[model samples]
Target: MPPTPPSTPARDEARIRDRGDACPGALRLHAADDGGLARLRLPAGRLTAHQVEALAVAAETLGDGRISLTSRGNAELRGLAEECGAELAALLAEAGLLPSPTHERVRNIVASPAAGLDGLGGPEVQLWARELDALLCAEPWAAALSGRFLFVLDDGRADVAGLGGDVTLVAVRPGAGQEPAARQESAAGQDPTAGRLHVGGRAWLVAGADAPRAALAAAGAFLDAARAAGNGAWRVRELPEGSTPDVAGALDRAGIAAEPVPPAESLLVHAPPLAPGPLGTASFHVLAPLGRLTAAQLRALLPAEEVRLTPWRGAVVVGAAPGHQDHARLAALDSHGLITRPDSPWAGVSACTGRPGCAKSRADVRADAAPGSARGLPVHYSGCERRCGHPHGTWVDVVATADGAYLVDGAPTPRTALPDAVTTARTGAIARAATPSTPAETTR
Candidate 1:
């Protein structure tokens, strides 16, 4: 039997928001200590070569000379002049990056980075992502969605199905028989290309062709629930207790046939991010060190037809040059300081904008957490208690302290011994629960 959907926290335990989300966007830049910060959402993380060039140009000309990748497969440009918003918007509009200003921030979508390239996955879900993006921008109500709202399209590989999306659609391969319960409501007949739509803890089986619309309808239902709850909830997961979205009703109202199904364990499995290196004969995957890409490093990925950013803060150069040319391109990227191999010391290490970039940072965590040999587990360095940009799932948490020392999974370690401590913690040499010196705080 399928497992019961987990229950949400009680009402008293729910976090009630008091204000609107302040997520920065291309047009709505956030004032940061570094300067104006703008986040550009890349649905399906798709970017043409020209678009890449445009981003490189924008990073060099308008903001910082570096581009930071967000965990959600988005790009961020920091240290911008406040008045450069218009110029930045114009530049993005020219590159076809900004389809609609109203829907720009709400266009958070992540898809399988290796889809259509590697033969392991089902169908090309990126096509669905593109269609859903167009549908989202055209709909007036979609703009009400919080910038944090996410849509994950897993192309049967289960790579991105666990990224905590508000609405997740995983393609089902042909001949993969459905559960008997799901088959009972197939009045519209079974589709050869079927997909599962998951919202909160509920799941539904819908035709692959109708998955996009069904996903959108699910989001609308969440918005309705959010409104009724009268709490400033940003994500479907943040809705009040007992407020699970009525996805089946929404899909029915949209004239799309769907079958209520048990949430699949495979969808929520913690799949590691795509490894960095050659993905296929025609594609190369690489990661930006510390999730920050200099203009030179970003350009090194160019001369390709297309690039798809991954949720793990990496990019896949698709349709790469053939034969010996591909080898040369890979070498160029490695020389430019991009992580071209999975075994690199920087592979599982990430840090937030510490010290000078963030006023809350007590130490320069990035400088201190420089590259070293690969550890057994992922490690993240946070400048403050609010660990921004930390990796999901099990990881070694390293936070800077107020006393000029550092915490390796809550164990106090002097600055001089930080490297060894971090390595030891990542290797799980000493298994202990993290006990931060300061009270735990949420990321801004």
Candidate 2:
């Protein structure tokens, strides 16, 4: 079983931000120890084959020769020259990846990657994401949103509902005699065309056609609550205690009829990520090792009509031929070093940019974590205590220490023992044994 998560911090202990977030976007590049880093948000993680090729070209010519996948289903180009910001922006814009300059940073959105292609789940929520992105860009007020604020759209499969989102919209599964429509309420008082909109701890039933606008309204409500509280909260979870956003009121003002759902009945269903493999007959899911893809690996996914990056640090290649042909494609991806099987050791393994790239890092954690063995739980290797790009929920936490050693789940271990120690921690053997005593500090 996954270990229980720690309790939420007290209101007084919550983070208080006095300045805006400095998250990098296509228009805004962040200067790191390695070089300039540009984050391009792919709402719903949708990318055309041409867009993929364009990113490959950008990475090879302007920045690092590799692309890094963020936990939020976004892409990052590192090792860029400071003067290439304008050029990078132009490249992305030409590829249609940068639609709105003002709303670039705030375009953080993730949806069920296998929605319509998988033959499971309800109404395709990817379409909903596109509509929401358009609505967000058109609204000038949305530019005020922090770059980290996220909107999650689940296709009733519960794939993305668990990902922490400021605003979440989940399609409601239709009954035997029902069909999805627009703004139509059934005789039983249920809206067949409605979805469950969750903001903070509250949830409401909203029409499918109105869901995109309702999601934006929810964000606006959060902004209002944050302003009233003067907490400068960037996410809904960061709002002051007891100051939940007035989502219902916001919906009412927008002329969107919303039905309040009781807290007990509004609990979201959590589902594991879509494992790497073929999904039904239309899509092939594959993972990038350590969430980094070489230019060659990126091109290996070509001939795909569309690619949807998943929040799990993988992608769903859509419009693939079924059966033998899809299997052949998966094999090709495997040849190029992508994780095409769930049993691959690289599965559930992630690491933050360490070593020369991040000045704060004490060691090259990624280099050390590359030989990791497969285990039951996910394992994340962090260069420092900040634990950037860590996975959500319970997992093995490996942090590099000042003494040039590692702390596997807080148990100090030497560098030479990392492999065995990490495997033990990930397999739950460390949790079952008596805690080890703190050892004397030692250099690697």
- The TM-score, computed over Cα atoms with residue i paired to residue i, of candidate 1 is 0.91
Expressed as tens digits, the lDDT of each residue in 1-444 for candidate 2 is 322223344555556778877778888887888899889999999999999999999999998899888878999899999899889888999999999999999999999998887678754588899999999999999999998899999988787888777899888755522223332253114544467899987888777888899999999999999898887888787787877899989999999878777677578777777889998786799999988999889888888889888787888898866667999999889999999999888899988898889888899988888435675777878887667777655668788999999888888889899888877777765432111111110000
Tell me which residue pairs clash in candidate 2: none
Can you give the lDDT of residue 212 in candidate 1? 90
- Number of clashing residue pairs in every model? 0, 0
Model 1: per-residue Cα lDDT over 351-405, one tens digit each: 8888788888999988888443485777878898678877665667778999998
RMSD of each: 4.6, 5.2
Q: Relative to the unseen true structure, what is the C-alpha lDDT of residue 387 in candidate 2, on a scale of 0 to 100?
A: 72
Please give the CA lDDT of all the candidate structures: 0.80, 0.81
